[model samples]
Target: MPTIPGSRTLSGRVLIIFVAFLIAALALVGRLAYLQLIKAPEYASMAESSRTVNVTIPAKRGTIYDRNGNVLATSVDATTIYCDPTMVDDPREMADALAECLGGKSDDYLALITQDTTFVYVKRKADVNKAESLKEKGLSGLYFLPDSRRVYPYGSSAGQIVGASNIDDVGITGLELYYDDILSGVPGKMVYEQSATGIPIPNATVVERDAADGQDIIISIDIDMQIYMEERLSQGVADMGGSDGTAVLMDAATGEIYAIASTPYFNPGDLSEVEDGATSIKAITSGLEPGSIFKTVSATAILENGKMTPDTEVFCPAYLAVDEYYIEDMHERGDMTMTFRDIIRDSSNVGISLSVDEYLGYDKLYDKILEYGLHSATGVDYPGEEVGFLSDYSEWSMTQAYNISFGQGITCTPLQMTRFYGALRNDGVAVTPHFLVSLPQSGETPEYETEQIIQNTEAVPTMVDMLQTVVEEGTGVDAQMEGFTVVGKTGTAEFALETGGYSTTMSNRDFVGFLPNSTSSLVCYVGVDHVPVTGAVTPIFRDIMTFAVDQYRIAEQ
Candidate 1:
């Protein structure tokens, strides 16, 4: 071909343009093939993540029932509101709408809706009505899922024992925490694909797994008795002008707790109203120095050792001096002769101290304490059960020995004291205190083993007689009932101060006893803390015992 002037140059330019286009086209084809073949799985995954959602389906929590089949705790149907943040069109408006319906600061909701994620929880286990209210507003990107809320029917009744769960229905305290795994069943899940606007596409790939419901629990608590005990305890604490109180009623023979109550109890349904120490079951958790009531254990040890008889006489001074400590009787009295029986009936600190020092000895008394399970937890079925503190007998000084004889220089929970007394009233056999009656789901019955804590069965009767004398004509006289033979001991412990001395203005007063002649007698313990008087707790015991006797017909039995 003949080229004109500048034609050759134009042809060269055209050729250069063609070569550049060919190279660019080849690069484009290579890039497309590389992406479609080698990088296909990675891109596919990214696309799948944007459109697919995995939703958790919560399993229904179980119900808690009392011995009488009263519902103490249960779960109700609720809804959880979630959203696809990527699908949200106007996050500010949606956040304001959510705050209006669900009760929160709009800023907080706004933060959640503006998150850079496919999905996020707006509210978990919210009230169905509230969730529905928000849904009615037709907010885009919002979704609802089924959930459950834990509820307590009786409110503060048995609140500490029954415990409570969190917003996620996870148990966090008391029996609920103790039996969480069994109460919180396995959760299910749903996997599905959604559109850009977060709606499930028709015939989309969906997979689901079923949830397993939690097992129901039936505890040994008697709701009626629990309510009655709580009422009496609250009234008693108020009447005594005390800071707080705790009480327990148990079958003397079986150690099956019928009613356990603590004053200033918290409402499980509303934890916001709870005060410090209100959620603790003081009967099993708090350790306090039990005063004259511990004399019963000393008396039992003295008699069991075969070293002292009920008629054995000891001279009691007004006060016994040991190591710069003068242990005086609750009441001032001149030196007098007292029998073992008299020492207990009068709650004579000096006499019991002499008896323990002269007869029971430190090692034997400590041995007896251990034998009665005073050094360990009662093996209660509830959570957070604390045992009494007792330094080894080898660590005791002479003054400490005498102090312990009359319920000082040592500490124990009210439940431990009740269990010890129960052994005395239960023919020297102590049964493990328990709240679990049966697991109906597994058809399982828990074993409550009995131990011969007081080996001298014959000595127990004498101990019982001495306790009866306490109610008849002694410090525990207020615990006496007109046709009932009451056997109990009274305690007045000085509250220890953090400043290395006992509080002069406050004391823990308690009464523990049982009806001896009644069948299936209940060993009851009532304690009031921060009381000014030594005998403020006995009347509470009297009132509760009277009701129990009449309700259970203990006298007739």
Candidate 2:
């Protein structure tokens, strides 16, 4: 056939343009296919977030129980009230209605309802009744979701030890804080579709992940014993009108704490009512000079080194000049010969100082103090435990050494001293004081465990016999129990002034005792601090120990 001069060029151009358009169409189709299939889930989530929100569901906290299966703390059902600010029709009116139903101020609710965001929490864990009241009004944009709040069953009993949790179920103090992660379980998640203005999309697909509840914690405390100690200590503090008082009872062989009580107790249910410095574990945290109670250490050191026997006699002077310091007995008896047992029974400050200095010297005395766990932390399974103070042997002057022998220059916590006495009860095996027996695992019951810190089995019988004499015939006569064969030591020390002296009026009176016949194996220690009255804590100790012995049905002597 025949073609015009320009026809061929124009035909070629038309073919090229057709090819380019066809390639572009195929490329566009391929890209669309890749996006719709390969990237579908990612884009879907992005779009869903624009119209849907993920809400967190808090899991129920684990139950806390005493050794006897009494509930100390637990989580109760509650509801959280929240709002999608964009969906509310009238911000002021909704706020006013919510304020009426709930207890919050109208202005606060009004501010939240007027927010430009998709969601806001009105109350994290509101009472169920309040949430129901709000729901009855059928307020737009507001929703009620299930939640949990911590509740204490026994009021203030064991308050400091069990601790408390926040509104969101997070532990803030005590064992609650110590075991927070184990107590606070996994949080759940839920995704729900909503409108642009934050209204729920009906019949929409909702994704959810169930939360796992926390593990239950079982501790060694006896609830009845805990309540008794708290009551008795509270009364003792009131009667003596002291600044503070602390008591701890433990299993002599196992070191498991049965009851630890402190005056100025707080209500864990309502933390707002806490007293000043009341929430601390004073028995484990507060360290003070332990006075005549420490004479047990001096006597033990003398016996342990064979420097003296129970019948070994020493001259007890009314005053002894050691270096620049003059050590004096509490009473003025002039100079008299006293047996080694008589020193502790009479609580002779001059006797202990002179005897320990002449016999065990400074290094052995300090070593014995540490041997009894007086200068170290008790390693209790509780927070705020302090290591009591003891000066190095290199820094000790003769006077400091003498003072330490009588429990004057050194310091020790109530828990440390309790464990020291506890060792004597357990045949000289010093065990670490602990509260947590075990944690529940795989739906099984928890078991109790014991950890021995030290052992000196031979010295214990002698120490026990001597201490029993203190209660039976000497200064600790106030701690005697008729049938149970109570053995204990007494302490009466002037409260040291922060500015470098001792308080003339206030003193720290302490008593630590144990029942030799009791199979339950109890060691009790009591300290009354900053009390103007003398002989304050020994009687309290006697009463508490008597009650505990009766409660446990310990066999009579």
Candidate 3:
């Protein structure tokens, strides 16, 4: 305890140093505790994210089959190549390798591999062999995942009906778009830990979910008949010098489509060659003026109202005047008296107009149009079915009535026209047209029950008799088949012009009918648009019907 001159000062300095050291030690310990306990999860998450990868696996799309189990559309196994750009050592080298294996520009692949993101797709749904070729090269940061590619085996045969899918196996058009949900199944996920070089760490954290495959669909189309119809339609369109053509063959009683085709077909497999407006199915989508073919409906209404019989005589002039508008027949002749049968046999526009004015008024004819489902869609299972254009009875003028009586000033799809003829063939009952035959996985079958469209059943046979006469002696004379009585009607509708009046130069020639005596329950409709001739479609109908009769071995009555 001896006090020197600087002893007290030195002791004070030591005490200050010790106090500062104690404070600093305590602060360091507290900081360590905070980091080790509180910030542990946050740091661990950051580390985990740096080394872990989560990948999505796409599910397989469904198969579309014909009624005979022929595959029209399906999904095939493929590979998807992806990569971690961060792990790629040389973007140019990898890009060059990919280009050689996959047939793409190296610069494009280079841009993808040089991306700042951790993962990017090199190619989706690549050909399996090509992907395998790249995998064998052992390119760094590259990965391959099992994928599916949509394939159409029949090509353009049923292209419009079956539709096509996009590169990612998503439906974009046709039946594919309609049933996309049912065809695209649930996707899966895979979570795995990997190294910084993009290699999986063995015995590390891994989680996976298996993908569910889509359901298969069976449609109500006979592929053989479809092929035949397409061939005939193409040839017919060429022969008639038509811009386009549509043909539909269906079960007369069931309304199940046997064959449906449209010309200028697009291949579902290769959409690049598809022309604009070629994807739409004209049978249900395009509405055309039905022309004299609609006379069958007019005749039916007249007989059903009991205002006229097949023998009911009406004076038919070359043309009938209706309030400054004259309705003339396709061909002009002298003023003559004609029975109801003769009017249909001659397809006389004047005769039908007179009968509608005297017997069936505009209001009743409008009612018959509604009753025949001409004013609405046929409620087919397919998408984009158009509801035909029909003015309300309240909106009808005297000229409009006359024009409508002769199948003018109105528009309807060929399928709708065919369905109306189907009602006549099916004893006044109109069956709903559909393409879905069955749902195999769910064991569900759609019921297409026949509904009575024509109230007076007796009028159906009388109308059928008149239609038979059309093929035998009228405009449909070319449609007559040997040893078969073809009951059909011919239509030559003037195309509407964009300017104002209808086009006198171009027309949509159509024929609709069914064999009354043949055992085959088939009704056919053939339409050629922009045809110069009047009866161009009748010969096409005759050819298709003859083939159908032979194919089905239809017994002659």
Q: What C-alpha lDDT do the candidate models reach, one value each?
A: 0.87, 0.83, 0.88
Whichever of 1 and 2 has more lDDT, that candidate is 1
Query: What lDDT score goes with residue 476 in model 2?
Result: 85
Q: What TM-score, computed on C-alpha atoms, does each candidate reach? A: 0.90, 0.91, 0.92
- Show where candidate 3 strays beyond 4 Å: 1-47, 196-200, 203-207
- In lDDT terms, how accurate is model 2? 0.83
Ranking by lDDT: 3, 1, 2
Tens-digit lDDT track of model 2 for 1-557: 77789998999999999999999999999899989998888998788879987889899999999988899999988898888888898899898988898777999989877877888999888889888888998878888888888899998899989988887678888899888998999999877798665669897746488878898988989989889999888888878878888999988788789999888888789987788877778888778899988898788777777667788889987788877778887767888999888998889998888788777787877777776677777778777888878989999988888888888888888888888788777766778788887676655543443434334456678888999899899888878777678888988887678898788888888889888866757889988888886555777888888888787887754
- Every model: Cα RMSD to truth: 5.0, 2.7, 3.7
Top candidate (lDDT): 3
| Model 1 stretches astray by more than 4 angstroms | 1-47, 104-108, 196-199, 203-207
In order of listing, the candidates' clash counts read 0, 1, 0
Ranking by TM-score: 3, 2, 1
| Superior candidate under TM-score, 1 versus 2 | 2
Q: Write the per-residue lDDT of candidate 1 for residues 1-557, one digit (tens) a residue.
A: 77588988999999999999999999999999999999999999989888888988888988888988899999999999899888788999999999999898999999988888878999998999999999999987898888888999999899999988887778988888888988899988877799877776778755488789898888878888888899999998888888999999998787788899887788889988788887869888889899889999999988888889878999988887899889898778999999888889888989998998898788999988998888898899888888978988888988889889989888999899999999888899988998878778888887888899998898899889988888898788888888888889998888788889888888889889998887656899999989876446888888888888777777634
Tens-digit per-residue lDDT, 294-332, candidate 3:
999899999899979989999988777788888788887
The stretch of ten residues in a row with the least summed lDDT in candidate 2 is 445-454
Evaluate residue 543 in candidate 2 and report its C-alpha lDDT on the 0 to 100 scale: 86
